[model samples]
Target: MILLRNLVFALFFGIGSVVIVGLAPVSALFGQRAMIRHATAWTRFHHQLVRWVLGIRVAVEGERPSGPALYAAKHQAMWETLELQMRLDGAAMVLKRELADIPVWGWAALRYGAIPVDREASAAALRQMIKDARRARAQGRSVLIFPEGTRVAPGETPPLKPGFAGLYGALDMPCVPVATDSGRCWPRKGLKRPGVITLRYGAAVPPGLPRRDAEALIHAGINALERRA
Candidate 1:
């Protein structure tokens, strides 16, 4: 039953995505942001469908970060990204610029304050990301950072990248560390795994002092999630 549902959704969204991407650029030229908004909302709706398809329930723990704190989280699965929109009243993600190349969804993300980073971590790329993030935060949006940069194998912890710590250092706002193991069921690629994913939101690290301190604290988050798995 789970496999069948996953397959159905995969087909439906996969095809629909093409249409949204194709139409988005033209819509943006006219400043018609509705399509992007629809795509964003649709993607979230799609995720809910995915949850039902796989019979996976997601539960978030602890308090959601308040104010413009840098939100650092584990990157074990893509589920964490989608779940944020529905879970938080206002949440933003620091994602790759390639996502912005997509049509409707990318346009909507820009409209909704999503920060896009460069693929190859370079000084210029990081600078652009920081600039974009700062702008978004100035507008009063919470930024979410997946410090590992890439998804690691289930139960494995990747080295915490300096970008997270650097961002933490540059921004004097509080930082929140969250942990999860959604990848055990949902492989990075292939059919979605069955059952609900459990997520634990750890406490916020008050912003002060220097950046190196963030590495230890962020690494602790990576370790904590691995322990949960």
Candidate 2:
């Protein structure tokens, strides 16, 4: 049954991506704001369609910080990627450079204003990321990133990567730590279970803290969710 649900969802996901991205140019003609709104609609559609089709409810706790803040979230599953956009009104996401290289999907992400970071080339990529992140901040959007760089299983806690701190210090924005248990249901691979996934946003970590201090604080904040789980 779970496999059947996932297969159906995958079908809709593919068709939806092609349709939305195909019509993206029409939105781009109006300008960046329109493009983001159009792209955001696609994300919201997926968020809703999942609940209606698969019965997976997304329960979000804590209010998202407004303005140009940095959101460092726990990477558990792909669900939070689009769900975060719905939560933050099409915020800019820091993703792998390869994702932006894909044909149609990549073009839409670039036009929609996602920050792509090259994980392999650490220094140069971080520099370019900060530059692009600042550009996104100037556009009045929040910066969303997974501090661990990749998704982890429910009980595993990985240290926050250097790029997260680099962006935190470089951008000099208030850092908001977020945690979620989407992996418990929608994992990185295999069957996805139908259940309510909780996304909890913790208090904001003030900017200008020492790297060690900020890392310690953010790690604790994100790990708190696992403790509760």
Candidate 3:
């Protein structure tokens, strides 16, 4: 039954995604705001599918960050990636270079204002990310980044990527560290299970702390829920 539900959800989800991406040209004709609206609608479609077909739901804890701030979230599954954007009411997502290279979808993401970083480029990538992030900030958008760089299992706690610190320091924005149990319901691979995925937003870490201090606070904050379990 779960398998059948997942298959159905995947089919609808895939079709919806293709349709949204297919309309990118039209959305682009209207400008970047239109493209972002299209992207948000696509995310809503995904959420509905997750709820109606997969029987999964999200429960957010604590106050959602407002205004221009840095959202540093734990990486567990693809679920939080979309959810965070919606909850933040449209943020400038910092993503990997490879994801931004995926033909039409990638082009649409760039049009919608995602900042892509090339991990292999190290220092250069950090510089480029800060530059892009500054542009996003100037445009009055909060920046959302998964500091861990890649998704991990529910219990795994990995050190954040160096780029996170660089961006944090450069952006000079208060950081909201978000923790989630998304992996419990949505695994990186295999069928997603039906359950409540709790997103717990920690207190905002003030900007301008030393790099080591900021990283430590963010690491502990994002792993707070996991640590208790």
Give the Cα-based TM-score of candidate 2 against the true structure.
Answer: 0.95
User: Which clashing pairs does model 2 show?
Assistant: none
- The pairs that clash in candidate 1 are 56-195, 56-196, 57-196
lDDT per residue (tens digit) for residues 43-102 in model 3: 888888999899998888888656789999998989888877777877999999999999
Off-target runs (Cα >4 Å) in candidate 3 are none
lDDT of 3 at 130: 96
Candidate 1 off by > 4 Å:
15-40
In model 1, state the lDDT of residue 189. 77
Against the unseen true structure, what C-alpha lDDT does each candidate score? 0.72, 0.87, 0.90
Query: TM-score winner among the candidates?
Result: 3
Would you estimate the TM-scores of all the predictions?
0.84, 0.95, 0.97
After TM-score superposition, what is the CA distance of residue 207 in candidate 3 from its true location, in Å?
Answer: 0.8
Q: Rank the candidates by TM-score, best first.
A: 3, 2, 1
Q: Decide which is better by TM-score, 2 or 3.
A: 3
Consecutive 10-residue window with the lowest summed lDDT within model 2: 59-68
In model 2, what lDDT does residue 42 have? 89
Q: In candidate 1, what are the lDDT values of residues 100-190, reduced to their tens digit?
A: 7776567766766777888677898888788877876786767788898888777777687767866777767778788888887788877
In candidate 1 the C-alpha lDDT for residue 131 amounts to 86
